[model samples]
Target chain A: MQIVLAILVGGAFGFVLDRIGATNPNVITGMLTLRRLRLMKTILLAIGTGSILMFGGQMLGLVEVGHMSVKAAYIGVFIGGLLLGAGWAASGFCPGTGVCAAATGRRDALFFIAGGLLGAAAYMATYPAWKASGLLADIAGGKVTLGTVPGSAYAGIWAVSGDLLGIVLGLVFVLVAFVLPEGIGGGHVQEMPAE
Target chain B: MTLDWKLGGILLGAVFFAAVLLVKPIGVSTQFVILDGIVADAVSPDFITQTDEGWTSTNAYMAKSSGKYAASAAGPLNYGFVFVLAMAVGAFLSSMLRGGVPLAERRAPEIWRANFGDTPWRRYAVAFAGGFVVLYGARLAGGCTSGHMMSGMMQTALSGYIFAAGAFLAAVPTAMLIYKEG
Candidate 1:
């Protein structure tokens, strides 16, 4: 029963995202360049709604507080994020949307999946070499998430959250998507007329 | 840009969740089935273990508990792997039903053509490099932002915030350069 509800909810989410034109690079780029805040607004709204539900779920004792996994490797995280960003721009699809594109049977997406899988395998294959080589020896096992936040060790782990960062990025993207227009978004989505 | 956001947002959230529950959970990480395939092809073919792990029983039963004494079951392929497969199937099915125009072959955008054509492997390289980076970070910090930021923050984990910030700082320059031309 619970699983069924989950499916019903997920399908609806996928459909709306596709329709929002979130699947389009133009919209994503628009958010980054500030030529259009459409994507930004959509993302913010998603985040906001998610936040409320999470908090509420916790207060109601419906969700587990400790079961959430927190395994992170700085280099991998940084590179993964950086790579994902570039891949999105270069390929016009991020991990999430890429899957969406693939489902639509976009030939390009099929290749992206192929490339992505190759990448994953490559990592696993190298795991032995990398681990033996001391790539991960420097870092200790997982620590509390907030411990990485600067000057916040005394403030508590929750303070480690980069909400400020998310907001800043969101705002920057929203602004760029709105103000820059041509240089950022299209330089001219319409191409001017007359004199 | 002009669509009704309230309705749109609700609908999308549902799509994401439904796909996960119905077919597989959604995770880009799982598309590595290609990796599984290649590994199966080149490696010893026994690289992935067949040993009895915890969820194998559930999978066996789900696989129809086929036969009287099968001794084991495949269950739902690794959690991540299943999600990845479902995502592709879901995306493809939805795109067609929605009447999205097929991406043109000849008229493929310069970005699309240049990126994939001049150097096909570069895509693989970038992906490899990116996965190396993301997974590394995920392991180091204790969790990817999805587990931390999205799931954690929602649950109010302090660490979630930390990971989220790091993810953004990392994503900035990459997004800028990649999308610079546009």
Candidate 2:
């Protein structure tokens, strides 16, 4: 039953990702370089909306805090994130988007998938070294949240309510998405006359 | 035809929200590791073995979590792995339904072409390199964009915000450097 739900949910997730032009490398880079804000806006809006719904649902008791999974905090996580960002900017594809793109018959995505598998294998080979490096050691109390979430095991860095903070931040994201221009400076998108 | 950007964004949020509400957060990169384990196990019987307790792997990473990963690797039909495959299938279905990805989209993107060239191999190389870097970094971080940034942020995890900041700090500079024309 869970596996079946995974397929249905994963399918819907991929469908939306493709429909929003995320399957296109150009669209991704365009957003990264600030050449195209449409996709960026869409991404921000999606994140914001999802945040609102999720946090709101939690507040209303419709969502289970126990189901919320919090990743452990470590120095490697931040450094790894920076590396991931560089790759994202350069390749214009993240794991999920790359898979979606490959499915769309973008031949390049196949290579990306191969590379990702290799990368994963490489990490597996070096897992012990990384574990010994202390970079994986917990920091900021390991699994902590920005604000206190009732019924969750995580500690709050701040005493504020996490649900409220999420909703507020989500609203800010949506607002920014709506206000952001399509392009900046003399990019191609900016060359078009305003509506 | 593709959905409108605004509508698409809303729908994307809805899907993510539903998944989190119903079961668990959406994530993908970890499955890549699982795939690697599965392949390794298949090629070498000794790579993963069934213990009295459960499954165990010669590889320590897979052996962690009480051989939970090894179990998934041995079985290979779990929720997370299948979800990733389903994502690809969904993308294919959507593309076909839209009468196939336009030729321009199926190949190098405009920004890429403008910055680099139309050579397919070059683009493929870059794509592969990028994928490699991202996956490696994701493993180090213990999560990817979906797991750490998107879902983590939704859960208000401090690590999620930290990861997000680090990602953009590196990404913006990298993008600026690579696509000087754009």
Candidate 3:
């Protein structure tokens, strides 16, 4: 039953990602460079909408706080995130989008997937060294929320209600998404390179 | 068959919310590690062993979480792994239903062409290298964009916001430097 649900859920997620142009390297790079704001707007709107729904649902007891999974805060995570960003800009494909692109018949994505596997293997080989580096040690309260939810295991960095904070921030993103122009300078038409 | 970005974004949010509400958050990077572990165990019989105590690995990282990683690798049919595989299937199906990949995706994107030329091999090489770097970083950070930024921030986790800041701090400058023509 769970596997079936996984297929349905995963399918919906990938389908939405592709439709949003995330499977296209051009779309990704375009967003990164601020040359095209379509994908960026979509991403922000999605995150914002999801946040509002999630936090709102939690507050209403329609969502389970226990299901919330907070990743541990560590120096390695910050460093690794920087690295991931560089790579994301270079490749224009993150892990999920890479897989989805390959399914869309983008041959380049297959190579990306291959490289990702090799990279994972390399990390596995060097896991011990990373562990010894102390970069993975917990920082702040490892696995903490910015604000407290009633039933979660994580500590809150602030005394405010996390649900309310999330909703407010989500609204801000949604507003930004709507107000942002397609391109800077009032959607100035830039000459796109020849296809 | 194509939806506008606004509708697409909303649907994406709906999917994410439903997943988190029903089961758990959506994450993809750890599956890459799981794939690696599965292959390693296949090639080296002793890499993973199942005892009465549960699954264990000679590799310390895999052996952590009370051998949870090793168990997933040994089983290879868990929820996360299946979800990733299904993601590919979903994408393919979406393309097919839309009458195959759109022309924009079939060839090199215009911006890439503007900067990198129209060589397929070069794009493939860069794509691979980029994927490698991303996966390595994800493992080190213990999550990827989906796991950390999207799901994490949705839950109002401070780590998610920090990861987002770190990502954009490097990504914007890197993108600007590489695609100077754009």
Backbone Cα, N, C clashes tallied per candidate: 66, 0, 0
Per-model TM-score versus the true fold: 0.63, 0.94, 0.94
Chain A TM-score, cand. 1: 0.64
Model with the higher lDDT, candidate 1 or 3: 3
Cα lDDT tens digits for candidate 2, A23-125: 8777777777777778777777888898899989999999987778899999999999998999999888889999999998888888888999999899989
For all candidates in order, the CA lDDT equals 0.42, 0.85, 0.84
What is the lDDT, from 0 to 100, of the residue A84 in candidate 1? Answer: 46
**True-structure Cα RMSD, model 3:** 2.4
Model 2: residues with Cα > 4 Å off, grouped in runs: A189-195
The digit string of per-residue lDDT tens for model 3 on B99-134 reads: 776565556555566787777788888888999999
Model 3 chain A worst lDDT window (10 residues): A185-194
Write candidate 3's Cα lDDT for A39-98 as tens digits: 878877888999999999999999998888989999988888998899899988899999
Once fitted onto the true fold, the runs of candidate 1 whose alpha carbons sit more than 4 angstroms away are A1-10, A63-75, A129-195, B1-26, B31-43, B52-80, B105-149, B156-182
Rank all candidate structures by their TM-score, best first, as comma-separated numbers. 2, 3, 1
Candidate 1 vs candidate 2, lDDT winner:
2
- What is the C-alpha DockQ of each candidate? 0.21, 0.65, 0.65
Top model number, lDDT: 2
Give the DockQ-based CAPRI class for model 2: medium
